[model samples]
Each structure stands twice: as C-alpha cells, then as structure tokens.
Target: MTPIGNLKPTIKIYDTTLRDGTQGEGVSLSADDKVKIALRLDKMGFHYIEGGWPGSNPKDMEFFDRIKKHQLKNAVITAFGSTCRPGVEPGQDANLKCLLDSGVKLATIFGKSWDFHVTKALNTTLEENLRMVEESVAFLKGNGLRVFFDAEHFFDGFKANEEYALAVLRAAVLGGAEAVILCDTNGGSMPFEIQQAVEQVAAELPGVELGIHAHNDSEMAVANSIMAVQAGVTQVQGTVNGLGERCGNANLCSIVPNLALKLGYTTIPRDNLSFLTELSRFVYEITNLNPVANQPFVGESAFAHKGGIHVSALMKEPGTYEHMDPASVGNVRRVLMSELSGLSNLLYKYKGLNLDKTSPEGRKVLEQLKKMEHKGYQFEAAEGSLELMLRKAMNGYREPFQLQSMRLILEVREQQPIHSEAVIKMRVGEEIVHTAAEGNGPVNALDNALRKALETIYPEVAALRLLDYKVRVLEEKAGTEAQVRVLIETGNGKETWGTVGVSTNIIEASWQALADSMAYGLLGEK
Candidate 1:
C-alpha cells in the first residue's frame, strides 16, 4: 500500500548557519570565515543560505558586500532581518531598506506572532503588529524580492490566541510572502503539538506554502520538523550543526539525511546528501566548536561500537545492531577496543589494523591492548596512535623519526617586579634543536616551544596548529594530585585529526599528545 503523501514527497532545505548559527553562544565568524563557509554550503547544494542580517552588524554587511563578486551556483543567498519596526512605515524603516538594497534576491523577515511579544516587546496593539507584518512583506514583494515570513513563536502564539496567530499568517500570505515559516521560537513544543498545530494551519490556509523553523530546547526540533512535514510543510529551516540561539535550532545535518533516506522525501539532491557529515564537521570547525560525538547519523561516535556482543553480531551482519549503514551518510563504522572488549572485539581491531586475526603475534597484540586498557589507556580516543602501536607490536612498524629526548623549562615573574621566560629542547634524529617562546600560560608555552623544535626538520608541521586542547582528571583521589587525560586536535591544510595522552602531570600529557599528532601526520604521509 502506498503511504499517504509519501509517493511524491518533497522538501526544501534552508540553511541559516551564517545568520542564526552565529547567534549560538561563543560563536562569531569573521567576514572572511563567513564567506568561506558560504562558498562551501553553496557547493554542497543547499537550496538557500541565510547570509546574515545585513544591517545588524558590520561583519554581516561586509560579508554581503564581498560576496557580490562571486557567482554562487545551486544556492540562493538570503539576507535575514525582522520586518519594519512597529509605528514605522516599511518604505522608511532603515532595516527594511538595508535588506532590500543588499542585492540579495531572497530575504527572510521575522514578525511577532505571539500577542505577548506584540503587546510587550513592540509596545503595540495587535492591529499594529498585523499592519507591520503586511506592510513589510508587501514592500519587499513589490521590490522584486522572494521573501519568507518567519512567524516567530507561531506554535506558542497559536496556543495563546488561535485567531491572532492565524491572523498573523494571513497577513503574511496576503502580503505575497513566498513562504510562511512557523517558528517554534522558544523551541518548547512537542512533536504531537507540532503536528496538530501544523495540520490545523495547513487545513485553514491551503493556498500558502508552509515552512518549519524549529529550535532544540526540548531536544525534539528535528522530530517536530518531520512531524510538520508529515502535516504538509514543504520547507525546513535549520543550522548546519544545530547551532543557533539558546539550545539551538534543528540540525540540518540530521534533518537532510533523515528526510531523504528514512522518510524518502526529496529535499537536497541525493549526491549532495552524502557530504552531510563532512559539511557538518566543516561548519563546526570554522565556528571553533567541537562536534557532539553522539549527534545522530553524522557524529564520530554515531557508528562507533565497543561491546563484545555487538561486535560479534556486527561481524556476521551489521544490521544486527546498526539502524543504517554508516556510509549512507559519509561516515565509517569504528570498532573500539577497551577493557569491555572480548576476543571478537580484538579480532575486529586486528582486522582494522590489517593484521591476520589468527596470527600468534596478533593474539599477543590483542592481549597487550587489553592489559593496557586495564591500566587506564583508552584506545578509543587515540585510534591513530593505537594503530601505530599495533604495527610496532607486530614488528612491521617503521619509525619516521626517533625522539632522543625533550626538555621544557618555564620561568615567570610579575612584570611589576620581575620577568619570566620558557624554553624547550628536543633531539630529533641525532640533531639537538632548541627553541624558546613566551606565553600567558604553561600549556601555551609548551605548545609553542615544541612546534618550534619540530619546524626545522618538518616544514609541513608549521601548517598544523592546535585547534583544541582538552583536559580531564582521571584520578582525583588526592585532590590536587591526580592523573589527567589530554586530548588535542591538530589540523593541517587538508584534514584534522585527534590524539590523546594521559599522565599525572598536565604538561606532560599535553606534550605527549602534541608529539603524537606531529608523528602521526608525518607517518601517515608515508
């Protein structure tokens, strides 16, 4: 039997990573970074990319000004802002004029849907809010603009006053909005409520195109969006990695693949969907935010497994545990080895290392890994290092360069009284290299010193920088005296990789991971 509305399902993806995504906590992309990311999104085939609020900030204005020269293919650049402020005519409002003059053919203007916001935030009555919505939308339409009206807090507004909410949407539709987007502004609505409200609105306004702009405060934005689609919405609005205000908007990374593969809805092209994971990571990297490991479909741990039973089952048939193949979303399955692993887990790791599972040497290596994991060595976070170690255990490994010794020294004094200095010395391939650097902190000093030492021998190492440095206390029994784990992410021009190190001394742990990152990069090239 054919599913209702499933035979010819269609969706339009509107990515607001540049606009709403920058509103996420601690996220601010420079104009150059914004343009670089925008080019990437356009190449990835997003239908619409919200460039930014043209008049809201200098960076956004600069981005639009700079992006005019490059011709974007397959994606329309959108300038986003609120409708003309209350008590002001659309033709005279600076914000509305700025959006129109930005040279962007597509524009998204949000208007107050909730009566509370209209009454309180705007300090205006319901009639004024309706006029603001209508006038702003009509002005943009008359100026040859494809406008999308974001009914901010639509669901909440509907619950508060159904007639007012319908009236707001009616204003947008009557004003010639290309799409009327229902925003779960507070992101507190559930899927059931979303379905009911969207169905009601669709039934009432059958002539208007519907869009869903949701947030993830309730952790149901993606689900709610899907429910809205089932209830007849055609456009989905979201950020690339669920980045936005508060708990963030729906994640386009998850939404695009879910609608395409699971629901069989056509939104982005099939070929473009395969780049979802890469694009998700790209945006996260540019924002200097770590990608959530557990995020659905595209995260690092989404396809990672460690349990013995699951590994055994997966070895025979991956469907035993996996909901979908990892490659379906441009990711690969990873078998993690730890204390909880059984022989099958060991075999899986062995196969990954390209070693014979039946070999005595392989068995010895597996036993060694189990013993090391028991001693607090985590292989999951140091997969590259673990692979190198496995090759060494099998006597098939070749060292790229031998480290003779490393010395790091730090000296500090208050500038008001005295000054300080730090130095690091290392012996690489029989040549002793020494370099000194100053930093505000001990870890920064150590990082600079070590990179200085390696740059002479490996010029390519200079292209890589430490993007992230994380520390975790493993054993805090003695309070200040405890073992810590350090994870470092390093990026060269082409790719980024993570390495881990653990020690009682934080400096030592950081150094170990830093060294491993450089070694892995050099060795992997061979």
Candidate 2:
C-alpha cells in the first residue's frame, strides 16, 4: 500500500454551492441569498466560496458586485469560469474578462483536459487547448488574482490518454496556477481509478498543490473524493448538500465528517463541525427542497432509533448502535415511538416524564399510544401531540383555551370566487370570547378565527405560523369515505413542531390537527 503518512494533514474546503449547486434542477438563489450563504460559510470557516460564473448570467454578475460590500472573516470569495475560447487570447476572451471584472481575490477556471473534448467539443487542435489552459491561468495570476485550474474530465482523460492529461496539468502549473483540481466530470469513475490517477498526478507534478472535484452520477462521488484525498489532495471542492448538475456533486456534509472524524484529517475547525446539520437544512429550505430524512450525517433520521433491541442496547451503551455522538455534528439522538417500539423505546422516550415503565400510569400511556397508532396516528413526526398526551396523563395538564362553539360559512356565486368564513367562541380562564374571520379556505378561516379569539388572552399565539400541512389517506381503498390523517407543522420563529389528527371527515381531521397545533404552541409558554 502507498504510505498514507504522506497525505496532507490539513485539507481546505472549497464550497461551490452558489455556483455548481444552483445547476441542480429546481435549485435557484438570488444574489442576496448567495451573500447570506457566503456569510454563513465564512462564519463556519470554509476556506473558499465559489460565487458563480460571472460570465453566464446577470444574476451571477450581480452576486459578485453585491458580495464585495460584505466583509467575510474566513473564506476567500472565488469567481468561476471557463478558460479562453478556441482561438481567443486570454486577455481578450469575454469569459476570462468577466472573471477579471468579478472583483474577487480568487478565480477558478475549468479547461477541457480530455484530448477528445478538444478535437470534438471545441473543434480545436490539441496544442490550442493546452495553450488556452496555460494562458488563462497566466493572465489571472498576472492580474493579482490567485488562480486555480480545474482539469475538467481529468480522470476519464487520464484513463484514455495518460500522457496528455498529465501534460495539461503540467501546463497549468507552468502558468503559475495555485492548484490544479482533478475532475471526474462525467461522475462515472471508480474509487480505485480516482486514487491511481490522483497518485500518478501527485508523483508527476511533484510539489504542486492538488484538489479533487467529483460528481455523484454513479453514486461514488463521496468515495472517489476520499480516495483522491488518500492519494494526495489538499483541497476538496464540493457543494453543500451535494447540490449540482445531474446526480449532484460530492456532498461536503458527508465528506467533512468522514475526513475529520474517521481519517484524522483536519478540514474546518473542529467546533464548526457541529453546525453541519443546521447548514444542510438551511440550504434545503432556501432552495425550497424537501430535506432527505435518511441522508447520512446531517439528516433528521440519521440518529433516530425505534427497534426495541436497538433502543435497549443504545440506552445501555450508546456506542452499541451509534457510530459517534449525535452532538458531534449538531444533531440529537431521537428515540422514536411507534408500533415498532417496545417498552425500551417507551421508557427512553418518556424518561423526562419520570414515570416507571411498570407503573399503572405508564402502562396506560403505552396502551393509549398503541391504540392511537392503530388508528393511524404517526408520532414520529408529530412529537408535539405525543408530548401533550404524556403531559395530560402525568400532570393533568389543562389547555389554555377550550372551544365552546364554531360555525363555518362558504359561498360561491356565478362569475365570482368562493369565499370562506369562520365564527368561533372559546373560554379562556373566566372569559368567553367570540370572533369571526374570513379566509381563502375553510381551514384557513378556522385558523384565522381561532387566532383572533385567543390573541387577546394568549398573545404569544400570534407568533405561531403554519409551516407545512400534509394529509394522508389512511384507508385508500375506501376512496371518498376513507379515513384521512392530517399533519400540521407549526413554528413560533425559533423552532417548529408537528401535530396530527385522523378522522373520516376531512374537515374534522383538519380541525383536530389545527387545534393540536395551537395547543402545542401554547404549552411552551406555560
């Protein structure tokens, strides 16, 4: 085996989330969003942030101009682009000129390293392609910007024509490129191929810095990246949450932890690793993408356990089921309660309630849990509702408000829109309040009326807002008469909680979920 001791102890993290990440389908960000994300990445200690291709669009150019106004503490903002065109000089090429004008200290430009791309894609001669790569780096370096050359398709090119691939990197180094990044552009290379190619490049290039940029088409991007690192790469270029074209780029979320925790390589500051999960979720939210619950390291279900034997073993010794402490990556271990749960799951879940598993009250709560789940209640997501049930059972909890009466009215006329209104009466302490509100739908009307009635007595309820509302048909075969389960996600700015209700009547089910959502939010205040 090649000696692993020669590998760089400190790896630099280069984030292209604002550029390559936006190439992923359905991922879009405003210049403001890019600046916000850059600030966060800088605060989190990323070494470099690739803003975008300033030559491609007005938005990216605007991003470059906007980002200059802010002071980033750690990361150097990088502008990305392609090398000079087939026949154009680096100083005259529009793309290269755009990079020069992007007002960033660093610039990364990708040039086709594969001989086939030069002959077919660019319809240019091999010598011209090599000149473009070299001259582009020279021009940028001469202009006071630090330059990094991306050898696009380097791995595949190396496999096809090893000599020419190495020559391309040699040209970049000769042009004073700070780093030559090897790219698996097609994302189809195996880990062993990556390691061998990267190692060969390191040997041939001697003291020149090397970086790795792997895509995830074959689901091997993360593996390929790690292999390259072992083969001698100091800089790792990736997008947060692995967002990129096609399948995606290598996920820094997974790569950083794997390097720091497993391989003993230092990437970001050790303390910054705990912000990984928060950063992952923030990206998903900004891009309007649903988070992958089971995604490794930073996902919601990454540390959740529900199996009885697993929970028993986990409670005894966390290492029996966990690889590392969840807190290490800013995540918490969750003991999920479900039909798959045993007494061990219950005891672990209800430990805060201070109830003995053998106690009558505990047994009753457990049976109620089972019965509710049998009726299509899913507590895993709606832990807020479960907490209310447990509190009522243990402490005789009373709700802040009790609904006395409700009325709904809907109207639809020819050539007019449908209108919905809700009237509600509720008791808060010794006061009986009445309120009416109109909305676009019955659920919205009810929510508005409820909020209007409770805000006077419990003004904190005004801060609560709906984040997500989902309905699942428990009995699909019953069609129109099916029992539907409604899950409502609510938040009070700081954090969010979920509540669920199931019934045959859709309206009743929605009411149940809505009321539980309100109840859960108020519970935090008391």
Kindly list the per-residue Cα lDDT of model 1 for residues 191-288, writing each as its tens digit: 99999999999999997889999999999999999999989999999999899999999998888888888777888878776788899899889999
Return the TM-score for each candidate structure: 0.81, 0.90
Q: Write the per-residue lDDT of candidate 2 for residues 15-67, one digit (tens) a residue.
A: 99999999999999999999889999998999999999999999999999998
How much lDDT does candidate 1 score? 0.84
Candidate 1 lDDT score at position 91: 95
Which pairs clash inside model 1? none
Backbone clashes counted, model 2:
0
Worst 10 residues of 1 by lDDT: 413-422
